[model samples]
Target: MNLKNKIVTVIGLGNSGVNAANLLSDAGAVVRATDSQDTPATREAQAALEKRNIKVEIGGHTENFIKGSRLIVVSPGVKESSVALQWAKEHHITIISELELGFRFSKGRIIAVTGTNGKSTVTTLIGEILKSGGKDTVVCGNIGNSLCQEIARIKDDTWVVIEVSSFQLERIEKFRPEIALILNITDDHMDRYNNFNDYFSVKSKIFRNQTADDILILNYDAPYLRDLKKKTRSNVIFYSKKEGSSDAYVKDGWVTCVSEGKIRRIARISDIRLKGAHNLENVLASAIAGLRAGVREDSIGRTVKNFIGLEHRFETVDTIDGVEYVDDSKGTTVDSTCRALESCDRPVILIAGGRDKLSDYTVIRGILRERVRQVILIGEAKERIRSSLDGTVESIFADTMPQAVELAGRFAKGGEIVLLSPMCSSFDMFRDYKHRGEVFKEAVKKLKTRRVPI
Candidate 1:
């Protein structure tokens, strides 16, 4: 893995690419980074890379910059279909994901979590539990902070807890984690992947390099994952909300884990601070990984109990005139939004729609009928969502977040909820889900001010 005097090109000048370039430069690799677009953040990243003697090409990728490179490191955002990547392939240039590059340079064991949903929650929980048990833990990847940036900080005993995505997994080569958890895979990222099976295959790459000594945790509730035992050599463990017949399950009102032929209670169902059955699955998966990683039961319990959940995932913005405004902008798929809707006890006025992922919104028809009172649609996917949910629920279309919040506020009455759980990506309007969630919160805040008696 000696990178001295080697030529390397990094595709996509996002945070991960910039970090990769810097790390490669530090390792004495001559790095050239390229991106299709130039932004303020990318510019800052470019300047930082330039200080390290790394060349950066923005606005478009150039073939000359990619040619004769010893290796090409791809950021998750970059597609395999990119012309430069295709050229690299044709030229027999070694191309690896940023995840792989990070792993090659990092020391100690790694715990990687991947899934369509609940990756961040599970990754964070695992990091927290490990830290609580006195383990040196560094959490990074997809959640934020590229793994390459944290690789230098890894010590012999450090536990690298990373939230991996299918995009990252798609390009992985020898990027095996000591402990790998696939929370659940549903129809997601259809816009990027050709089909659902293609997406699932990319996710399965996470376990490709795992050996029998490693451990892999999966969701038993997902039928697609039930038969993955044959796919990997690693010891497979299943976590489910149902009782009995799994490595981790809820029985007698407690989240229990079967380890070393002994059943142990990790935490009570009521003790989990995060709402929803989906979160219960997250806790169960994390608890198994925690216990397997040598974290004490008390430490796992304490972490889960205290974990308030991540922002933008079922996050409560504020209560205005007895109506609760929940920001679930992280619900970037139909299944995620349905789970959010199912988790709610009160009737909801759901604010949904964004850049559609080619998801079948009809999958959540039953939940929409049972939980949602009225649906306020926004963003590019509004019409598609409305068409899918036309007869299932009452609908309203708004052009902006403020308009959506105002409309929801009008429809929402006392004891009801106004939820922003857009079942689509926020790229059409906002920079990302976090930005979308922030805007939704700001709009809700303004709604409160408007309704306040001066």
Candidate 2:
């Protein structure tokens, strides 16, 4: 952990990569960074790092750099089996994530949230509640600023709220959160892990090192996580959208968290700002973390009332000629898009298809057929998605986002919804889900209104 001119090599020049390299350099570490892509995102990052005297290798991994470094810091997106990482392992050099490094310097209590979905929403909501309670808080990790950049200057009383992913958790050692929350675990990132169990184990490690004094919060409704609760040694506080099973329960449109026979209730579900049942799960998890952090009941209710949703996750784009358009670009998995469909009360013209995440699309197929009036497919996995849900719903293929939006606009009737909720990834057609959502919104805005048959 000593930063007295240590030679630290950063792998993958992505968002966390560039930020980590900068942080290490700022801490007086001799930093060298590498990435596979030299695209605009990476190139712009490389130029910025160059101004700070950091060395970067783009388009390929350099074995010499890995062998020569005293320590290697990896970005979350890169897999453990990546060539540079394997090289470092063979050379017996220590490899760690930015989160691990951040923990080494962080002074405040860490409230970490990890799951397949809704982690960002829960993390943000918990931060808001703590801040409203007059606590010094920084919402970092996958949602806000990187922890490596934020943790260094935070005061002792500050709260570090992080939305960690399975990728981040895979590399963490001794990075324990005071309140560890597992929102829900579904089949996501199967391509990253050896299997579903491997992914689940990595996520469960968030509470693996925690003591009895630390809090472990889980979604009791999720079968996978509910089963995990029985295995973990940490004291658990369970939450659910249904009644009777969880320590925190939502019944008759209100959410109540019961701990040690003390009940704290949020008056009405309608008062919660974020949309969808998925968001209700987020609110419950956040409330549990807030209570664990000793946030006042009044502050928890007030913050829940004021907390809005995250971008590209069921964001309403526009309504043209009474047809609603929604962008849920953050829904890059089958489970996420399924919740998006469940959130709608009206029939939908769903836009889906992107790079395959090795996810079985059948789970959402029945929901789509029952709730969606039509589907416009785009991106790399269009054919696979159509193949998976053949004859269940009306499907159309479009290579471009504008064309998909145009077709959806044509099929959308008044009072019906048009949604862009690709149940896969955005690597095929856009930079990421944000760019994909922005393009979908722009295309919907350009839709011309015309009289259509109901």
- Best-matching candidate per lDDT: 1
Residues 91-173, model 2: lDDT tens digits = 99888898888888788889999988888788888888998988999999988688988856688999999989888887888
TM-score of each: 0.98, 0.95
Q: Where does model 2 exceed 4 Å of error?
A: 448-454
lDDT of 1 by residue, 334-365 (tens): 88998898889999999999998899888988
- lDDT of candidate 1 vs native? 0.91
How many backbone clashes can be found in candidate 2? 0
Q: What lDDT does candidate 2 reach at residue 100? A: 88
Q: What local lDDT score does residue 171 receive in model 1, on the 0 to 100 scale?
A: 81
